[model samples]
Target chain A: MIAEVLTIGDELLTGNTIDSNSAYIAQRLTERGYWVRRITTVGDDVGEIMSVIREILNRKPSVLVISGGLGPTHDDVTMLAVAKALGRDLVLCEDCLERIKQFYEELHRNGLIDDPTLNEARKKMAYLPEGATPLENTEGAAPGAYIEYEGVKIFVLPGMPREMKAMLEREVLPRIGERKFIQKKFLAEITDESKLAPILNEAIERFRVKIHSSPKGFGKFIGIIIFAEDEAKVKEVVEFMEGKGIRFMEGW
Target chain B: MIAEVLTIGDELLTGNTIDSNSAYIAQRLTERGYWVRRITTVGDDVGEIMSVIREILNRKPSVLVISGGLGPTHDDVTMLAVAKALGRDLVLCEDCLERIKQFYEELHRNGLIDDPTLNEARKKMAYLPEGATPLENTEGAAPGAYIEYEGVKIFVLPGMPREMKAMLEREVLPRIGERKFIQKKFLAEITDESKLAPILNEAIERFRVKIHSSPKGFGKFIGIIIFAEDEAKVKEVVEFMEGKGIRFMEGW
Candidate 1:
């Protein structure tokens, strides 16, 4: 399956924050056998976010993962943008509101909060797109929203790394099921990538595997990654390269 | 001025690499008073790269900074994609070629290279989009490229962080000129962001300054950023917030 990640925040666009959340999501998705095609980050502008969502939805990847802008502030517009793009109304999820209330009550008991009543900003976190299911947020007040649009599974999670990670692990991963990918890495003490480029290209074409070579500076070694769903094809390319007198190191 | 960043590499999409390049470029641009609107990352695919370029070009940001895929490997397709997107041919830049040759000659003299002769893959780095100027690379073999399309300034730099940084500092920064931005950050020990959201919204509307409040964990403190082009407006908002019993800390 193919997946794409869209992250939204003005802080991210202005270099105020580095998007480690997308990297974490991509890594998890890749581990689950999803080929992440693209990762796009936009600011908190609603128009830009909506246009990007429309574009990505046009691509119709099997899964679209969105993160960020799920806070209880003026700039938190991810849910609204998604609703506008999907042509859905923003509706309050009662379960999500109950959870937020309970969370604040516990915080108030622990002296973390002065009031347990759901304020306007806190109630904003309970609203999701119509017909969307609210994903439980174990770490934060803003519950994530999930919806299936035109056969594409769209998952919207918070931008905070801690909250997003907990929700992803608990809510998103289980539904993705299990799949394995064939990937191998070979390191060789080759000085020139230009010299090995032709052979690598030939192996890629012959075995139908994607081969990537990174030259580790001058006079060091070259790292090669052979990735494909066909394990046998990757092995064939590796054997071919080894037969060409390239000494493969123990690990990448 | 508005700016956007595009980072290209398959390793980035596969989660093998985190894109620090975009953040670096965005920070530099932001410091120069350019409001960075979006940052897009795509894998080493020609079609995807071309489509993203077309999309960003349609947005017509004042500046577009592109990094990565300027290497001597099969997956290095950024230059080719840019050329195709602009309907320009891939022409060998003589200046860039000379620099590549000199770079290899120095490597050979220092015993870092066995052959000083430019091979096919190395020569590929010398080819750039037609009518594009080459930016000298002080740290690597591949030279960067700069072009103007539809009144928008576009810069393509190397993917390697060291080389990209060197080229950016040396060649790119000077042409961008200097612009000052008024930005002040206030940290307050507040537990509830929801309670302060209305005040922040009013402050934003009153002074026309972009104010962002980041809740620093549970029951700790909130960091608020006040940004605007008008220094007087920022100061007025700061004073108003302080007058409203919000104890402002020393610094962000």
Candidate 2:
């Protein structure tokens, strides 16, 4: 299945933040056999967020994972954008409100908070798109949400790395399940990538496998990765390299 | 002026590579007063690359920086994609070819390369979109390129972090010149972000400055930044905070 990741935050666009969240999500999805097509990042502008959601919907990715902008602050507009794009109202979800209340109460009990009252800004986290199911957040205050629109499964998570990761592992990954593919990495202590181009091209053409050669340094070493769905084809490529007197070190 | 960044590579999409290039470019552009609206990443597929370029063109960002997919491998189809997107033919640039030839010869003389002859794979780096000027790469084999379509200035740089940074500083930054803006940052120890929401919203509504409050921890500290073109307005916000008896630690 094909997937796309959309990260929303002005901090991201302004370079105040470096997005490691998208990389983590993409890696997890790829390991589960989803072909991640694109990763698009935009600021907190509602129009931009809405436009991106509309585009992703038009593309019809089997899975669309969105991160960031799910916070109590005014800048946190991802939920509102999603609601507008899906043509749904921003409604207070009782379950999400209950969770938020419990979160604040726990903080108060722990002497971390003086006021446990849910203010307007804090209550905003409980307002999700109508008909959306809230994904419980074990790490933070705002609960994530999930919705299905026209065969596309949308997963929305918080921008905080800790919260996003915990929710993704517990809530999102199970929905994706898993698939098997043959992936192998081989390294050679050679300098120029151009030197390996011919052999790598030949093996790619012969075995019908995707090969990537990255030059680490001018005269140092190169890392090559061979990937394909067919295990036998990957094996054949390895054999071809061995027969060509090219010694490759194993492991990624 | 507004800007956008497009990063191309399957490794990035597969999460094998984290994109720091876009962050670097966005930071530099923001420092120069360019409002970076979006940062888009796609795989090595030619169709996806071309589609993203077309979309960026349609959006008409004043400065569009593209990095990655400038290598000699078969997957490096960025130049081809840009050529097709602009409806221009891919043509060999004599200057780029001479530079590539000299680069290999120098590497051979330094005992870094055994073959000085430019192979087909190496020659691929010399091709540029028609009417595009090649930007000298002081650190790598492939030279960067610059092309102007309509009013948008398009910069295509190598994917390698070292080469991309070197070329950007030496070639791209000069073309953008400089722009001045008033910016300030303050840190405060506080628990709930909701507590500061009202004040921040009032500041944003009253002044033309942009404010961002980042929660460092649950009840530890928050970093706030105020940015604008007017220095007096930024100062007003700081004075206003003092008037409200909100003590904030100085410095970014």
Candidate 3:
């Protein structure tokens, strides 16, 4: 399976905020054997968001994960963008409204300060697209929404790291857990890449491995990663390089 | 100015490594009033790297900041990728070689203990594409390279945050300081967006304002921002909205 990540926020694009969400999502998706082909960041502009979503959809990733937006603020328009990308209308759903009301009541019962700002934030969560499945947010007031349209599952989560991370772990990962993939890394310290060129060539020829060679600065360090579905094939390639007098480094 | 960020690494795409490099670049670029349009992360695959570089170029981003693949390891193929993207041949520069040698000598003097592994790391940093300008890295053995090809200024920095941040702050930012841009942000609570919609339209018609309105969940928790060249015009729009009973939130 393949996925693409879209992080929507002016803060990220303008450098007011750091985007740790996309990185975290990409890492998790890769570990699950899904290739995240591209990651995009754009301002809160709906047109830009729509263009990016359309472009990535044409590329046809099975899943598209979007983080940011989902706040009760003016720049939070991720859900709107997703709907526009799918050519769907931004319709407020009854379930979403109930979710928002329940969330507010819970907060009020918990003696959390009840203010207009909090209510507004809760109301924004209630305004989701029609036919969208609202994901429960145990971490924050913003309830995440998931919509499967055009054979692509679009997961819309809040911009807050705590909410996004929790929802992704609870709601998204399980749905994407069917695929299998293997990753192997090789680290070696070699100064002269030209000298090792012949050995690297030989190793690739000797073993059926997807080998990638990267030589670090002025010849002080070298690392390689061989990825493949077959563990034996991966090990064989690593063994071949080890036989060539290549010493492995700390991180496998 | 507009910039695109390309952070290359299998570790970054994988869950094992967290990519703090792109965020660092994005923050620095945004601070300089440069809009980071997109961030692309690719594995060590040469074809994928080439495609991403081409796509970023097609978007006409003035600056392209790339990190990773500068290590002295077999997997480090950033320089090779740069060469392929720029259609340049890799050449070992004598100046870079001398820099590498000096770095090794410094390590030895500091009792860092020279090993074959360490020497190999330094050697890989010496190779660069033809006509590339080598940027020195005082923190590490790998020296970064910068090259302007076909109107796009490409910056190749180390993946290590400390080294990359230093080079960016010292070398990159100063060179980009000549450009002029003004950033304006406006925030308002959820005041009837319908009522403010026409006013925003009028403001956009009068001044070159990039206006975006997002609902935050309640009647008073709407957020909006206007980016424009004129500071006075931006403030006037906010004040106009405030006079229309639109409460200004923080970030104005």
Candidate 4:
């Protein structure tokens, strides 16, 4: 399956943030046998986020995971953008509003926040797209949304690393699918990366496997990761490359 | 000026790498007074890289900095993809070829490699799109390309962080422009981010300054960054927000 990650935040665009969130999401999706086609990052602006989401939907990826801009702030307009992109209206999830209220109240009770009251800003977190199921956020106030629009599953997640990771594992992963591919990492003892290119190409062409090689350093070690349906296939490709004079050390 | 970054690498797509390169590029671009609108990451496939480059170009960004897939391996098709995207031809850069040969030969001379042969793989690094200037890579063999296409300045740099950073600083930064922004980072003493929304939005609207806010925690501190053309403009926004009862520390 093909997947795409869209991370929305002004911090990301201006480089105030390094966006380790997309990498985490991409790795999880890749482990689940999804070919993450692309990862796109835009600011927290609704128009830009909406335009990019529409473009991603047009490409018809099997799944789309959107992270960031789901908070109560004015710039956190991801939910509104997702609704606009899907041609859906934003509707209040009463259940979500109740949870958000409790979350704030609990924070207030613990002296973490000054107010336990729900104002317009806090109330904003309760709205989801018309057809989206509110994904529970056990770690944060913003409730994620899961929408299946025109055969593509789109998820809106929080931007905070701790919150996004919790929501993704608890709410997102269970919905995508099971992991199916076997990925083996190895360090190939090649004198240089260029010398390994031709043999690597021939191996990939011969075997029904996917291989990615990157230079580890100037000399004798290059990192190569092999992906296949089973261990046998990985071994076959490994043997073929080994026969071509590439020495391998498992798992660097 | 508006800018965008496209990072091409299978490792990035697979989440094997976190794409810290784009963040570094974006930060430098922002410091240079460019609004980095979007950052895109795609695999090392030629079609994928070319299509994304064409899309980014279509947006008419003032500058586009592309990193990754600029190596000697078979997957390093960035130059070829860039040529196709711009409807140009990949021509051999004679000076670049000499440098690449020397780079590899030096490694061999240092006993870093078994041989320093200019095979098709190694020679691939010396090609640049027609009419593009070859950017010197002081950290690696592959020479980057700087192309001025249809009013957009496009830079293709290496995937390695050390190489990309060196080329970006030594070659890319000098060509883009001088740094021209004043960014002030502050920790706003707010009860919650939700409460800071309307005031933050109003400050941005009143002053010609950009404001980005993210929650530091569930507590009374939220990180806010202000971007303005001058220190006076930033101070005006800061005072306006302070008038709204949001106490701010000088810096975080």
Candidate 5:
């Protein structure tokens, strides 16, 4: 299955913040047997986000995970953009608003905040793209959204690492798939680069797997990763190479 | 003044790598006064890379900085993709081949590799799109390419962070014009969100500046960043906000 990742935030485009969110999301999606074909980062821009979403939809990825811009700030326009892209509207979730109110009230009780009232800004977090199922936020006030549009699963998550991770584990992964994205790594002991080159080419030709090899200082060992549909396929490719005189070390 | 970043690597798409190169490039581009609008990542597949490059060129950004997939591997097809996207042929860069030969020879001398022969894999790094100038790679064997096609300054650099940084500083930055990208951050003392929201919105309205404000908790201070074409514009927005009773703290 093919997937795409979209990260939204001006901080990312400004280079003030490195987008570690997409990496984490991509890793999770890859583990779920989704080939993350394209990953895009854009600012907190409605038009840009909407147009990118449209483009991704046109490409027909099975799933699209969008991170960031789901905050209470004025620039947090991902939900609005998502609505517009899908030709929907923004609708307030009463359950989400209630949870947000209680979240702040609990914080107020713990002396973390001076006020417990939910202003318009905080209330904005409760508004999601119309028809999106509200995914509970265990770590923060902003709840994520899971919407399926035109057979494509679209997920909207927070930008904060802690919150995004919690939501992905609790709400996102269970919905993607059970197929495993299996890849096995090995260190091949090879003194001659020429001997291994042909073997590597033959392995690629024979097996329906993607092999990545990087020379580890070019001395006696090179690191190789075999990715396939299942663990057995990875092991099969490894054994085929080993049979051709490519010895695998105990560790990489 | 607009720039886009395209990073090519299977490692990046598979989440084996975090794509720090784009952030570093974007930061440098931002320092050179280019507003990095979007950052995209794709695998080493030539067709995928070529399609994305064409899409980026169609967007007509003033600059497009592409990093990665310049190494000597089966998957390193960025140079080929770039050539195809620009409707040019891959011409052998003789000087680049000489440098690659010498680099491997030096490695062989240093006992890093068993052979220094210019094999097909190593020699493949010497090819470039027709009419493109080879950008010297001081840290590695592969030489980067800088080509201006249809008014867009396209730079293709190595994926290795060290090599990419060296080429960017020594070669890429000199060719791009000198324009400062300045943003000033301040910690504004404000206890209420309602108090600073108007000031921030007003500041955005008054100056041609991009303002970002994040609450540092429900506490007495919020972080603000004013971004503009020049330093004076940023300072002007800051002063206008300060005049509206927003007290600035010394540090973040």
Candidate 6:
């Protein structure tokens, strides 16, 4: 199975805010055995959000995870686009309202703040797509949104790393079960990548493979990942390289 | 201008590899005033990669930044999809090859490793699409690929955060210069969001404005952002809200 992650924020595009959400989500998704093919980051523009979401849906990914723009701020329009894409009405979730009320009441009881600001926050969290399941956020105020339509699961979480991480671990991962996977890698310590051009070509031709080059310290060491679904075939391909005197340093 | 970010790797999806590269790229793009509109994460499947790329293209982002899958690995086919997307033939960049050789020699001189491994690593970085510009990775073995076709700029960077950051800062940012942008945020305290919801809706409808619900404490604190081409207009929109009793927060 495959998944696509979409992070929403204008701050992300301007380089003002580094999108830690995508990295966290990507790592979690990968560990769950879903093939995370592509990650997209968009600003809080409705047209852009709608366009990207529509495009991802066309690819028919098993799942789509989105972050940011669920806030009740002026630029926070992620919910709107999500509702538009999923063909759902953006209605207030009463359950979310009660959760907010109770939370503020507790905080007020503790003298966190006199005003408590509970209803204001609750009103923001109350808005959700019709029929979307609200992912409880025990750590933060804003709850994440989970919608399953047409057998494709779409999870929406806050852009804040802490909140996103909590929801992903507590809610997202459980929905995606464990699956099998294979890993492979190729390593070389040579200098001129051009000299190995023919070799790379040959490997691709013979094993139907593609290799990545990770050169470190002015080309002192290079690591390449050779991945596949078939572990045995990958081993066979590595053996062929070993025949040509290429030794595996790690990952196969 | 709008830019779309693409991160490729099964590791990202299966929850093994954290895609920090996307954040780095998104932050950089955002700083340049280019809306990092959509970030799509996909695995190492050729068909899926192609489909997602096509989908991003359909969104008509001015630039596309891609990271990962540029290895000598069996699953690293990002270049192939890119080549196919551009209808170009895959070829080797000779300068990149020479750089790889020099990189290896330095590595060997520092006693990092022997020559045989260097040979394989260099080979891994040699493949390129015809007419592509090779962006040397000083931090890693894989030389990044930068291709400009039509009016869209497409960059292929190593998945490693270090390599991606190095190339993006040294090479990509300079290419995208001086774009205009405005960042605005609005805060409302001592008021219920539900009371202001109808007002916000009316304000948006009356003035053709956009606002998001950024509830910080689930209902305790709230923030709204309004992004526009005109900084003055963004402020005007915020003022319009304040006129309606929505106070100001930070980052306006």
TM-score of chain B of each: 0.88, 0.88, 0.82, 0.91, 0.90, 0.80
Model 3 residue B245 CA deviation (Å) reads 7.3
**Deviating ranges (above 4 Å) for candidate 3:** A109-124, A127-132, A149-151, A178-252, B113-123, B179-252
Judge candidate 4 at residue B188 and give its lDDT. Answer: 90
Question: Could you tell which candidate, 1 or 2, scores higher by DockQ?
Answer: 1
Query: Per-prediction count of colliding residue pairs?
Result: 0, 0, 52, 0, 0, 78
| B190-232: candidate 6 lDDT, tens digit per residue | 3455666677777667665445455554444665656554777
Query: Ten-residue segment with the worst summed lDDT in candidate 6 chain A?
Result: A212-221
Predicted candidate 6 versus true structure: per-residue lDDT over A41-74, tens digit per residue: 7778788788878878877889889998766555
Best by DockQ: 4
**What tens-digit string does per-residue lDDT give for candidate 5 at B80-164?**
9999999999999999999999999999899877788888878889999999999999999899999999999999999989999
Error of 6 at A189 (Å): 12
Ordered by lDDT, highest first, the candidates read 4, 5, 2, 1, 3, 6
For model 1, residues B145-174, the per-residue Cα lDDT tens digits are: 999999889999999999999999998888
Q: For residues A63-155, could you state the per-residue lDDT of candidate 5 as single tens digits?
A: 999999887766788999999999999999999999999999999999988788898888999999889999999998899999999999999
RMSD for each of the candidates: 2.9, 3.2, 5.3, 2.4, 2.5, 6.5
Look at candidate 2 and give me any clashing residue pairs. none
lDDT of 4 by residue, A1-252 (tens): 899999999889888889899999998888788999999999988899989998998899999999998887667899998998888899999999999999999998988777788988889999999989999999989999999999999999999999999999999999988766678999998655667878877887888566788766654578899987789989899888888888999976
iRMSD per prediction, in order: 2.4, 2.7, 4.3, 2.1, 2.6, 5.0
Model 6 regions more than 4 Å off: A29-31, A116-121, A169-252, B71-76, B116-121, B178-252
Q: What digit string (tens of lDDT, one per residue) describes model 4 on residues B1-252?
A: 899999998898888889899999998898888899999999888898888999998999999999998887667889999999999999999999999999999999998787788877788889999999999999899999999988999999998999999999898888877757778999998655666878887987888677778766664678889988889988889888888899999776
Cα deviation of B34 in candidate 3 (Å)? Answer: 1.8
* List of clashing residue pairs for candidate 5: none
lDDT of 3 at A33: 65
Q: Identify the candidate with maximal lDDT.
A: 4
Off by over 4 Å in 2: A180-183, A188-222, A227-237, A240-247, B181-183, B188-210, B219-222, B228-237, B244-246
- Model 3 chain A weakest 10-residue run by lDDT: A113-122
